[model samples]
Target: MRRLPLAILAIALLVAGCDDAGASPAAQGSTAPAASAGGACQLLDFGMVNAKLGLDLSVAAGASLDNTFTCVLQAKGVSYPDLVLAVSSTTIDADVFGDMIQPKNATAVQGLGVAGYQMPTPAAGKAGPGVEVGWLAGNKRIIELSLRFAPGTPDQRAADAVPKVVELAKLIDLSSL
Candidate 1:
């Protein structure tokens, strides 16, 4: 439970420390702590996300570090409605996907990757209501997308984010990362 969030924070910090010079928002850079970091941002562009999530947004930043790639997308010139993506190395087995990878409240999802889960993110502090979709990709990799709405967004719209997040998750190609 607590392990997942800590792992994500560590990955994010590692990504932030890497250099992304000359890398366009779409490229996600080739620099990494180890190995050639592939084009992770290409997995889902703004158009793909906007079409599925019904929001106009742009890539704020993207970079890859170690075995993880991180991308952040958001509405132009605003911080609200931030969508963060992470594709990273994984060790979890599919057999324990539910019991180990996801919390008790998470819903099991299929077809997105080797195994998948979706869960609602409750608002806390400066963060707003959101939805998270996570899936296991090939080569022991996992992808997690967290989409957080504006704090004042209506309850229905926040609830609606669940399906949208799942749809956005499907756009990611498991073989690419």
Candidate 2:
């Protein structure tokens, strides 16, 4: 369960490098890992996304990175070129992790089917960092919105990723999974 953040980090690096791609104000980036049965969960398709968010996802071929429940979208005029929407029925319970970040900075979400928070992740290069917004729903299902931009980008662009995650979280229904 402890490996959850590293796994998330690996994904972030992938997203940073266009490689691949948790929650809680539990610390901005901290997450409590729980065990859950995999393979049974359902991932939302691109059609489920709201076009108004500027995330133009299509049901084109190879759009999905992980066939089971992961969709990767290519960015157009958007600030971030790599956007990943991933849904999972993770066993890790987020409630047990305490608070990842101070409640002040963490945005308390309501009616989103779960307790969600947004955390900014810092990177080594010039691109700055990306924000990961995640929530726990139903039993142990976790829905995460990971957004990464090109390296050495401006800090404002990195900071802009937070609100986007929250907006997308509302559009997704974790219970359906």
Q: Each candidate's lDDT (Cα)?
A: 0.66, 0.47
Candidate with best lDDT? 1
Count: clashes, candidate 1: 0
Q: Would you give me the overall lDDT of model 1?
A: 0.66
| Candidate 2 lDDT over residue span 70-106, tens digit each | 4344433333445565555455555642254213355
Query: Which candidate gets the maximum TM-score versus the true structure?
Result: 1
Which stretches of model 1 miss by more than 4 angstroms?
5-7, 10-39, 174-177
State model 2's lDDT: 0.47
In terms of lDDT, the poorest run of 10 residues in model 1 is: 28-37
Model 2 RMSD in angstroms: 10.4
lDDT of 1 by residue, 133-176 (tens): 88777657778888878777665776888988888787674435
